[model samples]
Target chain A: MRRALTLVVSGMVAALLGILALGGLSAAATATDKEAANEAKSVSEAAKRAGKKDPYAPVVYGDR
Target chain B: MVEQTTGVGAPPVRRVRDALPLYAVAAAVTVLVLAPLAAPGYALLYDMVFVPRQPLSWDLVAPAQTLPRAVPMDALMSLVTQLVPGWAVQRVALGGAVLLAAVGAGRLVPTERLAVRLLAAVAYAWTPYLAERLLIGQWGLLLAYAALPWLVRAALDLRAGRDGALARVVLAAAPAAITPTGGLIALGTVVLLVWDRTRLRRSALVVGGVALLNAPWVTAALVTGAGGSSDPAGVAAFAARSENWAGPLVALAGTGGVWSAQATPSSRAAPLVPLATLLLLILAGVGAGLLRRRLPPGTAVRLAVLAGIACLLAALGVLPGGAAALRWAVVHLPGAGLLRDGQKFLAPYALLLVVCAALGAERLVARIDREVAGVVLVGLLLLPVAVMPDLAFGGAGRLRPVSYPADWQVVAERVAGEPGEILALPLSAYQAYPWNPGRVVLDPLPRYLPGTVLTDDTLRVGDVAVAGENPRLREVRRVLAEGLPVSATGVRWVVVQHQLPSEVDPATLRDLEAVHEGPFLTLYRNPAVPPESNPPGLGAWAVVMALGAALLVVMAAAISALHRRPTAW
Candidate 1:
């Protein structure tokens, strides 16, 4: 009975951690994706504003 | 009282065998949190700026006009980057902060259980306080966060009259003393923990020594032309912010209420985060009793008082009537502006919380069956990481390093060829470069260039603009607002950065001659102004003397610590 109770509690804790980890990682990835999309959208908008004058290509500082 | 057997006289192999797991766990935590820093370039986030080789200019060592925010930190960075490249220095600093913080917390916990120690290590190192500070690029504060546990341990040892403990206290506080806020925190910790009427002389000596370490910034503040008062608007702008529906006070309770929304981890906004915080609080309460029983006589009460004061300070800006009081104090009281962003003061509370929670876990496991104890311990160990997993891989790649444009080096070379005061145009304090997408960084020109570079000091938080204290910059702004030409400002050179939303009026460049025009930065020379070298004055020398004295204390402490037999630290 004691061994069975231990296994049950351990399983519950493992499941909780797994759910929290998955949720956190998914949210983080979504935030990163959203940031990249916004960057691309801004670049496009800036190019449109510039028309044919230099195309307004900003220098790349670093990459992930 | 809690078996102070920190492997002092244990056999060498046995000590290493016992210590191996703690070190391994710390190493794992460091690697997990700072994985993105393995990349080559510098991570230029908000206030975190790194150049190839920072020049040891007088302005960096002792600010003549502005407040000494960076103070001795910039001076030390300039000195070190002269020998080691800035990239390596950045990596070592960030990595060492994470590793040392974990090890320090793990060692400081008054427990013999390796699992409990490991729990404290993971919890303390992976805290939201460290995460938010690291994300905001306040590496100096993170150094203090890392040094805190060691400082607390040494202070405790000093209270107990342990040999070599005073030296340990000095050595532990040296890294923390690099910045004004960190130095003040270290000083407060020593005074609170080491003060005893019976050992009044020793306590005074230790407190005075830490105060001397803080002297460099204090001396600089006195000599600066910019008066001590700060803008009252900053009190509202830098107040602890609410992360989610839990509000700001609860956020502070969890050690996560940094001012900037951009610096907070996304997982903190989860609805269930407050539940985790509540659980941790309950555990800490349960373990508080254990801590009181285990620590020597009055040590636990002193620690509790210290933690309470830290929490109160962190919540001060958001408390009832707190904002009004802080606003008045910042305007009327000197150096009270430091209390505006009170969330930074939460380091001691976070440390105490983690230690208590770890002890609480130990107490729970003590009553449970062995198998169930293992399961509970594992769960608690994973709790912090599970709740805030976004802190991994450099805050989910927010800390990715980027290389500066060749234009920076080109501009630096020209400025070095002919030393002169240069003005960074477009008049914005923070820049959101297309190159560093989705990140706002302070202008790197001040640190990257050789001579004094004038950048805007006004800080804009969302819609609120807090005024700066630089009289020269204020005058420059006034001239520009009046639509004057760059030549009329009397700055030797003007560098206009392109590709930002802020537009530079073509009329401002009327009387100036364009020097080197890069794709990113355009350098123009003002023929009306001539290059002049200003030698360091007496005020600068006073700051230098203070820095020298602080360095000597640390050196003396190091020699003493190394020579002592059976070191308590």
Candidate 2:
């Protein structure tokens, strides 16, 4: 009985973590998330504007 | 467990003397647990929590990069670091993990052995590293090291042929599989499992499953450029380029070797606070554990013997005159070579020393009359616990302000409110920096945990790896180093000092200014440097990989449980 319950819980935890990640990956950025996104984008843009460009130029490299 | 009869109808043995040690251990553990609550800021528990918690790293960088939650011996520190961060959450984590570990140990050993195990844990909990981690809030190291007793249980289970099907072993192996130096403990487990081939199939399943559980980290390392990357002899060459044979050794035991930020020399070892334990290790002749074994370790003594060998190999070097020891010491010991401080060993070695002391306590107790043994062992364990700060096992001190006050979120929000990229001076903050460097940067390619910079960029810890593969990014680093690309280029906010690079100096700071100062922190802002200055790739793939690995583990566990009637013993 205990073993069976543990199995159920393990599945539940994984599923929960998976769905959460998927939600994060797929969902449109929310107001807060977008603010965070903008913050990151600005940091990158500033790095470029400041001459500390994204040394890797990530968008073009291995974008496949 | 071994003493229990297998007959369907046989009544389980019930007796007092047989159970005395366990009860004594429980009573001792209770006292130790209560110590942290009463004392508030004991250093031993603080250090325990600090390393895994990555407290030092936080003191080094910006706030956005801090982890969502803390791990290990560092929980209380993480909480304290953040303004009495709610323990309801961390309490659940720490209590659950520790309880699960105790259950894991209970499955394999007699109550006496379990008590001995707990005794060892109490010793490590009280070590200087743990204390420092606790005070500073290094959750990762705390959880990882706190998981040591269970790893002992794991090793014993493997030896007993129970590794074949123990589900608890899978759960128990969780923290060790996840922490910074986890790979070492896992490697040690593999050695023990290999030593007992009778249960090869079972051992393989258990060990392999545990390793599989680490796939998220391993995959992160791989995708990030670790295992199959150009960094093999690559990055170490750079760290070692300046060092001669004598360098790592002197740095190993001495104060601040190559990585020292200070102008003067100082030994890196922390003053072990549970001083009685240190005296015990030397007088009891533990240096033997380091010298005795070379091949696959056979017994518990041998496993410990090898564990010490591994630490010494990292500490002294494994080769002749500490040569190989220095090499292995630097490369193999989970978080060694990369991070600046050599004192990382303080956590693991101190745990080992404490375990030995616990064993010593067990012996001391066993020798005396029954009534006296319980009293003496509890007294010894209680000494540290009783004085424990809020973070320690038996501490009575309230959580005091570490160099940084506990209001991390405030720091985070304040940094988020800043205009430019900031550098966390002491960059090894916590496990989060490894995952998210945008939150803090000592350098362009965040060193990630206790490893190196400019080296792998793979950012691998244990089996987990986060590949930072962008050849173009490398070229960018070279250019930026020559000089910040432009005013718009340099990092804007620096959480602390000393981590700033040559290029981003006077010219860089001409525009940047400190905007806010907390009780323990100074927030700087460069109105000219925008927040979007240097952005990293969205970790979409890494997230997929971590979730994927976690899924695989859950599946394998379910399938295995159904097929095999793993002896719960």
Candidate 3:
């Protein structure tokens, strides 16, 4: 019964969780347009501190 | 009788009652599989479309999703998409699992009806695949695994009442028609059934059934490019991508992504999985030994052995102790030949071992640890999950935010300031367009670019022979002269990712154009474009995708509620 309840409640929670996930995501999606100056500043500072690991890091043949 | 309906439509009442549990399980699986769409990257579809065929060409055509050996099961999805109106092929894979799992559980413990139903839910709920967090985006694997329990159940069904030879043959052969791995699993299982029973006729029939089912896919592969068409050297190079023994297993066990190294606590727990897996293997061996004398005649011992072999194969690439084993058998195993990242075989290995270990735990639960059954059984079941990094549950998904690479908005904003057509390289996060109905030379994609050669090894710029050699300069010159380059035909801003290293300079080659720079990418102007030429802003496909998705959700919900459930079965 507990297992069954876990499945059921977990399922319900998954559904409820879906709303949160959706809200969190879509909010972020539009918020993407609202580029905070602070984020840019932090990103620039961090780039200087650490190396720039651009998203597309190709597999350098020799590096591999 | 129980209102028997036949031929084209809804199954009879008795059949419905018998399969009710499967129905619930199927529904749950369908939900979980499609749920990834709510996340970014449309990751479920993206993985399905791209990972199998990484490194895009200028045209960005999606041929890799269906190329090469043509996994029989995934090919069936192309047919499913073609024949079955309005069905997303990915969901069908999950449906297949839910279906077979239903049958398998139904057959194994029919008396435990509620338990069977619950297990079906837990099957998805707690599966390593479920927790792996990444979508089980492989349509072929889904189809292949789905057919498993059905085959197993059919074997058990043969043991029961009426002669079930034909059904067993069909079920056993079904996997062979799906994915090769799945087909292998099916063939192996059928071989076990036959070897144990000494039933040559049965074995032949099952094998024949699979061959018959796969006839079209095999023919198609031959026509396009079968395994023969594969670049032996290229494939070798790809498969040559080496990983540690534990990599695949660690990744697979981390199915939920909770146990991922990126997850906060992953490093602490990751090293322990090999130990747990080893313990489970020993337990499986002991379980087999203890039950050897009291087995279910032929099939039991044979199946247990086959399952053992499958586990050994997966572990050879995963377990720390398997180094000696992998070295000894590396030449003889098919994994050495075809299985790249022998670690990917980890997921399959985990499934096999978990099942075997579950059987062991089942025995232990019954005989010695009935009092601590929950502790011991759940512990054994969770060893892989706990050790896995992906299974971390951060409230719901990940605790940290996942950012799409080269944020589209930033790219678009940079383009707005430019006075020419914006041609961009392939964004790592999403597919670029070619048809924005605008002057963006490389719409979102550039398949329209001629001589967009794709070879066996490198994905894009297949024309380039090793990176250092400068044949690419000639190709680029040719491309610049041709329609493939955005700047070739009067587009000013030639935007490319700075990360994509090319030996040639954008300014030096063309001898013309001013350049605008974005924080992420560089935009070069085509001096050829007459003054005051400006391409329209980025096109509206993302909007189209958004609208199409909203409509699909409504359609799916409506279909779920209004469509008569009986017709679906």
Candidate 4:
């Protein structure tokens, strides 16, 4: 009975830890996503204003 | 798999656990080298065209059939992008490649000591070819490069009749998920297998396995009629042009390829020869000399011959008689166009050199005291990073990725439900984006608008253009020369990229209505358009691929299970 109790508690603890770890990972990923979104918006606005040709396009290769 | 020592001075890898530390170090270094990728908002400059905004689909894999180059990696990336953000996927993939190459190279080394294997891995994974290609954005080819060591190890293991060798071969062939280079390597491996008559059964199995792995791309190429013509200038453009007769030699030693000035690293550790690269060259020479005494005579000879052939091929453009030979081969041969960039063949040569250096390092340790050997090995391993710091993470200066304009996102969103084909205007294959100065980004329009079939046939290779028929080309030309007339052209929507050079003024179109107008792009809609037709048998092809991939995974899992059983090993 005592051994069973110990096993059950340990299993619960392990599950809890796993969930916490996963939550941390997701949190980090979310932060990165938000940052990327903000940067994309900024760059897009800049690109709209600049309106220059794609410098890395294949046509440029022909020129080179 | 059981470790079998076929050649002299061979030390067995006791267990898989013994390889873990080296792999860990490799993983850490890989992460370090690509640290810039971990940065927020950065996207790779290369083919982000298929960066997944929506769920993965048949459209993602179908392009392999029609595209000239079968880049299975793009499909894989698309699948990955479904879960991970697009900005992070390239960095993760490249880091994974570096780790894979390191582990694979470590396994190929026949040395007893762990240090030698680790050092060899560093040499193999951190070559000038790797840096140059990564900088140029040929990650698919690099995936194949990373798998080369594993392929060799598996081939050697199979020859020895080691259990689970077939499984290793299957795993190594996984790189076929990215590039057709694995198939090419497998072909060479089969040739090697042919040399040993006793390994005939294993060789046949290896061939079948390789064929199965390569089926998606191979079938696609066959179905699309992909590889026949060669353009002389196109062939010449990618040919390995050495600076001098010894140019290829110097490049292999340290500097880089002879082709593009951009291949040079952003920063130099030394003006002439990076101290680390020179050390590797010296080590390789020493290793070669020791090969006859330490390793099997035949194996040693084969390694030297392979390296020599690679060097010869790499120098073919710049050498006195080489250009003529290369020209002849390109003109006369059927699939010789694939070898246009002959320098890529040097990857195997680099592999052999690393193995040789590892063996030589082992010999040096045996002769000298531990203290002296330790100093020498550590210095050699660290010198590469010291000499070429930019290669560590910055990709020689192109680490940050620029985002597509929000106009692209908005346009893609607007066309999400459209069924008809959308034609992109200023129909140039490659365009330099002003947003990211001096860097080129492939058309992101198709990537943004997943719902529609985007048509632009400006992609070319020398004089031989891509798979657009004369009639279609004529129609496109006419549409571009004259403004889009709704009834004449079948295109439902015309996307005019105002920033690029275009023959016709999109605003001048009479019948087409301006549906959406933005700063950089203008979308015009046609009133009359036909319904979409299903691509013949493409669904069937997708099913076959799905089944084939599932089968491989099942087989691999079964083999792994069998390997785990005590009696089986």
CA shift of B481, model 1, Å: 0.5
lDDT (10s digit) by residue, model 4, range B357-382: 77777776667555556655665566
TM-score, chain B, model 3, is: 0.53
lDDT of 3 at A57: 21
| lDDT computed for candidate 2 | 0.39
Error in Å for residue B277 of model 3: 3.2
Greater-TM-score candidate between 2 and 3: 3
List TM-score per model, in order.
Answer: 0.94, 0.51, 0.52, 0.76
Candidate numbers sorted by DockQ from highest down: 1, 4, 3, 2
All candidates' chain B TM-scores are 0.98, 0.54, 0.53, 0.82
Query: Model 1, B178: alpha-carbon shift in Å?
Result: 0.8
Kindly state the fnat score of candidate 2. 0.01
Q: Which fraction of the native contacts appears in each prediction?
A: 0.21, 0.01, 0.01, 0.13
Pairs that collide in candidate 1 are none
Candidate 1 chain B weakest ten by summed lDDT: B1-10
At residue B132, give the lDDT of candidate 3: 28
**Could you give candidate 1's per-residue lDDT for residues B1-569 as a string of tens digits?**
24344556778688788778989999998988887677789898888998899999999999999999998999999999999999999999889999999999998888989999999999999999999999889999999999999999999888877889999999999999999999989998999999988988998999999999999999999999889999998888888989899999899888899987668887898999999999999999999999998899888999889889998888888899999999999999998988988889899999999999999999988988777788888888888989999998788878877888889899888888777788998887777676776677888989999888899988776556688899999889888889888788889999999888667898889989888898789999888888887898999999999999999999999999988956535
Rank the models by lDDT, top first: 1, 4, 2, 3
- Name model 2 segments beyond 4 Å from true: A1-64, B1-124, B127-129, B132-137, B158-164, B223-298, B317-320, B323-486, B490-547, B554-569
Q: Which candidate is the best by DockQ?
A: 1
